[model samples]
Target: MTDSTIWWVLAGLVVGAELLTGTFYLLMVSAGLIGAAIAAHLGVSLPFQIAVAALLGGGLSVALRFYRKAAAAKNPLSKTDGNLDVGARVMVDAWATDGTAQVKYRGANWVAMPVTGETPTPGMHQIEEVVGSRLLIKKL
Candidate 1:
């Protein structure tokens, strides 16, 4: 029907897609659609309205993604087990070679590596840092 109506419909689609994707990217597009609709309602030109929407929505999405990446890179445990077993002591189940080893912690076997020093032997060890599924460890 009308341009504004089309924008609203597109916004609804964006929100729906975002829900399915479980990411905030589409949500930003929906927000852009809302901006476009608002601009349209304000009697703005079609091109200007679309531009505003694209800039607002796309800009926000990119900013959010950048922030998330920066935060995650700053803190590796931002998404993983940060509080659980972090800075806790565990037992080593293997040795180190080229900064990689295996350790047993909390009744689970985890591959560990020394980030600064030699690899811990099978027994008591301390969890130093965790990057992804690997744990950087030190002898306790």
Candidate 2:
């Protein structure tokens, strides 16, 4: 019946939906709804309550989106937890003219590229990252 009660109900519904769909975005909105409920209980005007809800929810959603994007950008295709080849060492006999090298690792020949900011030279290298079948190697 009270404005705060209504806001609390909305927040509860958003949380329930998030649980069913497993969508993280809804939790941001729920946080906003809870903020609005607090504002209502403080005897704030309806307009101010609405603004509080919108600002909290929208800001949180945008923040979460950007956070996810940044995290994805940082994650390479060769995940440290999933791939054992990362950090393994191999010998490079020679580097081709194109700045790539073919090295025998794990009983097979693999194409490798020098890690960024490192010069490509023939010697022992460590697998820093793996993108598909290509290996990113850095001088050890």
Candidate 3:
């Protein structure tokens, strides 16, 4: 097969792997491979083709990392809602002196704590966030 065709095949394989892994970083590297394929189609030297591919892949990967970090910072509690616990209302029978208690939630006992400095009374509470196995709660 021709050099350009080989590069295109490599790019396709990388893209397929990215789909299976659910990592966008692999797709970024595939972009570099496509760039190298384009350089080969243009009859560029092997070293230049490799350089184009490497630069494109590395740059895109770094940009994607920054974007993911920024998105996480903007929505820190996004994943908590998917647990079927966060935002669910629960009945707090009692609370400890430190504003913590064990409450029944989603058919399971969960350690709950107040989100703010104000102490929560024994009544209806809303699950504001889930941190690990614990719940950050607020008065309903």
Question: What is the Cα-based lDDT of residue 135 in candidate 2?
Answer: 93
In the order shown, what is each candidate's alpha-carbon RMSD? 5.1, 5.8, 3.8
lDDT string, candidate 1, 49-116, tens digits: 88988998999899989999999888786533555766788766667565566666767778887667
What TM-score does model 3 achieve against the real structure? Answer: 0.69
Q: lDDT: which candidate is best?
A: 2
Best by TM-score: 3
Candidate 3 deviant stretches above 4 angstroms: 78-84, 92-121, 128-140
Instruction: Encode model 2's per-residue lDDT on 1-140: one tens digit a residue.
Output: 99999999999999999999999999999999999999999999999999999999999999999999999789855457668899999999999999999999999999999989989988999998889899999999
Model 3, position 32: C-alpha lDDT score:
98
- Residue 116 of model 3 has an lDDT of 73
lDDT of 1: 0.80
Q: Of models 1 and 3, which has the larger lDDT?
A: 3
- Residue 65 C-alpha lDDT in model 2: 100
| lDDT of each residue in 12-107, candidate 3, tens digit only | 999999989998899999999999999999999999999999999999999999999999888876747457777789888999887789999768
Per-prediction TM-score? 0.64, 0.57, 0.69
Q: What is the lDDT of residue 77 in candidate 2?
A: 56
